[model samples]
Target: MRLALVLAGRYPDLRGSQVLVQQLADGIRGRGHAVHLVTYGAVASGRPGPRAGRIVRDLGLVVRLWRTVRREAIDLIHAHNYEAAIASLVVGRATGRPVVYHGHNALAEELPLYFRARRARGLAHRLGRLLDAHVPRRADFCIAVTEELGEILRRRGVAARDLTCIAPAAAPCDAAAHGPRVGSEALVCYAGNLDGYQNLGFLLRSFARVRARVPAARLVLVTHAAPGALRRAVGPGVEIVRAASYDEVRARLDAADVAVSPRAERYGFPMKLLNYMAAGKAIVASAGSAKGLRDGVTGRIVPDGDEVAFAAAVVELLSDAAARARLGTAARHAVEDPRAWDGVLDRIERVYRNVLAARSAASTDPEASAPDGLGVAAE
Candidate 1:
């Protein structure tokens, strides 16, 4: 089937939503379906054509969507994030096509909105929940990344039966990425944006303790701002690296002895664990991180903020080659063998099919449902 996936941003971007858009496109296409991506790009620059190309890409992205939706003859519109979901809502209304909203994270619930008062936090939550409920109603089905998130959608009034799971897709890289044999310097890798709700500072303290025992341990920070904004943690062995491509990241995973995740449980799903698992690396993540992992089979999950336990897990994995190898093997196999990947994609497709079916059913019912004004005007 031909699928038009909507992204919350433009092409040549590095945000989480963009990455998911690229991955979903790759995965669905791998399954023999045609997929096209729509995202924003720079437009209306003060500089001339070539130079101005970098200004306000989001505006150009809307134009791209307008043209592509018509040119590609897309079968299903799949919206990846909030803005793109709004775009899909617009396209679906304009063209009478079925739109599938793939909910990646629960930001409206996890964080505040519109800068409301402290007393309004409860009220803000109610509104966020309401928005979440209304946002995906336009779609035939809502695809959530985790069961926890799926439940959030349901709590906001999404039909439980209407939600599907498409585990985030991660591509594995070559062993050469293992990087120069890793040596006695046990390297720990953390990759993601340092901004927003991610509690990296907590993880740094945890890592310091780990370093005390494992003196040769090194920490590699690959974040959008870490290389510049984040000061080096007070440690001798820690090393901060800038963000790398999929290939370079895989190489780091291939080389590193262990991977760590210290996300606050209340924040959101740590999609990075899936990436580490896909690369066949042993992980030392919080229980929140392990939520998506299979535990003893895939990797160890410690309680959130338990630096001693978190550090111990890292050291244990670092010290035991056989256990690390075993866990790493399990994590890799977890992606493909007897796991729910195929089911995940099937759920995604099911959402599209059901939405189309219901929308078709609706066309005969006389109320061609109007578009919900969820998509925010591009900034």
Candidate 2:
């Protein structure tokens, strides 16, 4: 089958969405299906320069997507995120093809973080909800990154048959292939964006408590922000490192004694958690952020925004080498379980086949009604 993967952001970007798209494209192609990527050439400059700039960019993206679908004779349109989903639906409507909307996060909860002004944020959030409610309904099928998100779609009136929960998969990490690594000081790393929903302020408070207990323990942040900017937000006593390439980030994870994800958001899954588990590092994450993780078996899960418990969990893991080792090993085993990338893509491939079959059957029978949007349970 020929597929067009549409993304609003730049292709081959460093964000989590980019990683998922790349994996899906590669996995689909590995199964002998043709996949073509259609993405904006650059990330949207967040500056509030002119609304006209964004309008023009989005229009161009839609035109390019339409041309690509036609030229490539695409069998299906698989779009990621909100803007890309809208564009895919437009093209699919024009071409009379089935479109699959991959819902990464509920924009209603995420968009407000981008605006600092109170009135602006309110307007943006309202607009986000409108789009969130309207766009997914138009797709032939919807893929939610987490069960929480799938439930949100259901609550918004999307049919149970129209939605599927397919969590993002982490690429396997070979801890031994990189050779013996010199261990650094007892370090805890948080590797992801510093957005408001990430709850980094709570992390800083928790880390401060951990520092009070273990003065020598260090807190390292791996993100795309400038060091000076992060220093201002996090205050002193923590190490701020610029985000590195994926390989370098994995290496850093391998070097750390404990990996931390302090995100408090309930609606979206944290991709960094997968990397920490794959690196065989003991994890301390908030309950909502640690999806698929068992409390005592895989890693330590603490209540969201509970600085006291979060700090205690980190301090405990840092203090006990044997316990950390045990948890790290378990975490690795949990992630490497049969439900990794191959299994994830296998389920997605089934979705493709089902949708195609339904489309074919509908085309052949004029008396038949529209195909039902069936949901595939996550493995």
Candidate 3:
């Protein structure tokens, strides 16, 4: 099938959503399906330009996508995030093609984090809610990245028949060698964007507690984000490292004694968690963000917002070599299924076929095109 994978942001970036989209496109192409990445660029430019520039870029994307669909005879448009999804829906209406909306996170929960002031954040939340209520429902089908997100879409009025939750998958990396390191400094790593939604402030506070007990422990913030203010505030015992590529990011995670995801965003799955598991790193993540982990099995799951417990969990894993080895091994084994990627692709293929079938049926029978009747037909 010919597919156009749409993303508003730059593609091939280290960000979670972009990483997932890149993997999906690669997988689809590997499976002999035609997949075109319709995104801004193949590399990140470090900073978002002016608002006016962003608007012009998006407008350009809509025009480019419309032309690509017509020229390529694309069978489907799979759009990621709100902006791309909205654009795809516009093209879908004009060209009579099905569009799938792949939801990464709830806009209402994530939008407010971009703002600092209380009043501005409140306004952002209101605007996000308005989009959340309208956007996903317009898609021919909605694919949510986590069960939590699927439920959120349902609550926001996306019909259950039109939605499905598929957890993001990762290719397994070579397990990092875990040998005993008594009397050695323990290294903890947090890799991702430095956005406010990442809850880095909480990570810093928790790391401070971790340091109180294990004075030699060091925390590293590995990201492409410029660490100007964050670096100034991190003080001693914390290092902010910039990763030039995803390969370097993985290498840093594999080298670390422990990996962490301090984000409390419950609805969205943290893509780093998949990387941590793939790298066989013992992890400590807040309960809300720990999507696929089992407490004391694959990784240490601490209650959200509890710096004390989060720190203690990291400390325990740091000191216990055997525990770390056992957990890391289990984590690696969890994602080693050679068939995992194939399974994800299979489900997605089914969605595409069904959506196309439903659209065909609707075109032939006008009554089948009713808003409530729009859904991916059963396999």
Please give each candidate's TM-score. 0.80, 0.91, 0.93
In terms of TM-score, the best-performing candidate is 3
Residue pairs in collision within model 1: 10-40, 40-61, 41-57, 42-56, 42-57, 43-56, 140-355, 177-251, 178-254, 178-255
Ranking by TM-score: 3, 2, 1
Write out the backbone clash pairs for model 2: 161-373
Candidates 1 and 2 compared: the better one by lDDT is 2
**TM-score, model 1 to reference:** 0.80
lDDT of 2 by residue, 233-339 (tens): 67456887766577767667778888998987777888888877777788999988998788877899999889999999999998888888898888877777645
Question: Candidate 2: global Cα-lDDT?
Answer: 0.80
Greater-lDDT candidate between 1 and 3: 3
**Model 3 per-residue lDDT at 52:** 56
Identify the leading candidate in terms of lDDT: 3
| Cα lDDT for residue 266, candidate 3 | 89
Give lDDT: candidate 3, residue 169: 70
- Which residue pairs show backbone clashes in model 3? none
